[model samples]
Target: MLRSSNPLEPTTASFGATDIPRKPNYDFERREREKTKAAESAKKAQAKAEKRAAEKGASDADQSGGS
Candidate 1:
């Protein structure tokens, strides 16, 4: 019973089916959780690597300075 004059606007006949909204897949939540977990793991690995490298650089500098 919509009174819109434009054809582009949704009318009463289609019942909003023509809008074509995306429906999420059944595994979407699981997939998203896995993706988040992977991202967090990668971030932690990168941080650990950076910390190790900084420690190694500091130790090397100290050894070279003492000589």
Candidate 2:
């Protein structure tokens, strides 16, 4: 058997994902994106609310102690 001289060539699998046909669904994709964004926003808001509550409690304690 003859050996190949160019062994540095990249194979098809090394080029990343395989070719696959996908149907474009703009409405579905938009809804999914909106859901993800809303969930993230809600998580951030909850964390912010908790932080604000903690800060407010600490401030109240400090004020009452000084009185």
Candidate 3:
């Protein structure tokens, strides 16, 4: 015999989730600072590489026989 499911019944367990201890001093500001620094460094490196490539292209064009 098949039993009918109760829609109102609690399916999951009521564990002590909210009872978890939090950090005494969370340095989210420091994490954001580091993230921004890393992003800026990457952007600078990308720009430098692009500039070098453009210089190289100009030099190659100058060296080529045909204009």
TM-score, every prediction: 0.62, 0.67, 0.56
Candidate 3: stretches off by over 4 Å: 1-26
Order the candidates by lDDT, highest first — what do you get? 1, 2, 3
- Where is model 2 more than 4 Å wrong at Cα? 1-20
Instruction: Please write out the lDDT profile of model 3 over residues 7-47, one tens digit for every residue.
Output: 66555565335867877554887888899999999999999
Question: What lDDT does each candidate get?
Answer: 0.90, 0.87, 0.81
Alpha carbon RMSD to native, model 2: 5.7
For candidate 3, what is the TM-score? 0.56
Evaluated at residue 38, the lDDT of candidate 1 is 100
Better of 2 and 3 by lDDT: 2
Per lDDT, the best of the predicted structures is 1
**Clashes by residue pair, model 3:** none
The order of the candidates by TM-score, greatest first, is 2, 1, 3
Top TM-score: which candidate number? 2
Q: Higher TM-score: candidate 2 or 3?
A: 2
Q: Model 1: per-residue lDDT, tens digit, 1-65?
A: 57888988767776746657789786988899999999999999999999999999999999999
Better of 1 and 2 by TM-score: 2
Tens digit of per-residue lDDT, candidate 2, span 1-67: 4345677755444466656888899999999999999999999999999999999999999999999
